[model samples]
Target: MLTLACSWLGMQWVHEAGHVLGALATGGEVERVVLHPLSISRTDLRTNPRPLVVTWAGPAFGVLAPLILWGMARGFSLDSAYLFRFFAGFCCLANGAYIGLGSFDAVGDCGELLRNGAAMGELWLFGALSSASGLILWNGQGRHFGLGNNGQPVPFRHCAGLAAITVGLISAGNLFFGTG
Candidate 1:
């Protein structure tokens, strides 16, 4: 549950950041971005000439940021690198489902993309690829979660501490920086 909470907030921030970046890249204006913890994240544009690009950026960057972070962690030979991979996979799965399943109702970013000339087939393809990637990343991660045998006992206390820290930091960030 702690990881889920952190992942939720992280996804919202990264996805919104992607929208902001896309808007700025296209010479558009971003009017407001809502990042409330209790609400779904969104970036409202004042002027958008490339809505499709902006819309695509949300999920694209959401998945990419975590993967990049995981890659860097692995490059450093970090012990907790699997956590980063899990986070990346979580982001991908969340974003993919948000785009794929939500397409049925033409909701959220999916709706925006479609309205801006995105083909349904393209959206489904992205969904399939992203979801598959996320699952692949998650494969063989059962040991970390204490489901598999690694010849040693899992550190429950350490995991709990990490979860606590994640919740605290994420909640604090949302309470502070997300208020606007």
Candidate 2:
């Protein structure tokens, strides 16, 4: 459990760090990188027209650490391998969900940049998907876990709903394909 927790945390760090690196690469200055117990945020210069690129960079950046860890996990014992794979899969899914959801802000931010003569189509799509999925999840979850947002204790019903969905997906997958 400790290993799983550590792996989760490590993956999150790498994912968030990717956003920071992307911001820097695209001529945007990172204002602050805040690491809290439950989450991290890389606040950057809002004035930069390349916010979409920076936002897209975050999820892309996050994939690196998990892939590296997945490679390392392959050489481990069976039990450890299972744990590592689970961790890797969870990280990938969670990060993908996050990127897809959080990028909604990119549309508005990118629009502003576009007005200033910066054009980016791919970034726009990434941002739109992220934002749309994020909004849907937020609505369903009954809370907002978004950039600059703080953690809140989720309601029990909400937790249960999420668990049921996860279990249902796993059960359906196993029943149909004999695999998770």
Worst 10 residues of 2 by lDDT: 138-147
Q: After superposition on all CA atoms, what RMSD does each candidate show versus the true structure?
A: 2.5, 15.2
Compare the candidates by lDDT and give the number of the best one: 1
Write down the TM-score of every candidate. Answer: 0.87, 0.48
Reference-based lDDT, each prediction: 0.84, 0.50
Best of the candidates, TM-score? 1
Model 2 lDDT tens row, 23-100: 778777766554433444334454454765665556665655665666686766433343344445555655655544
Tens digits of lDDT, candidate 1, 1-180: 566677787778888889999999999899988776678888889999998999999899999999999999999998778778888998999899888888889999999989989999888988888899999999998787667567344477647866776677567657755655
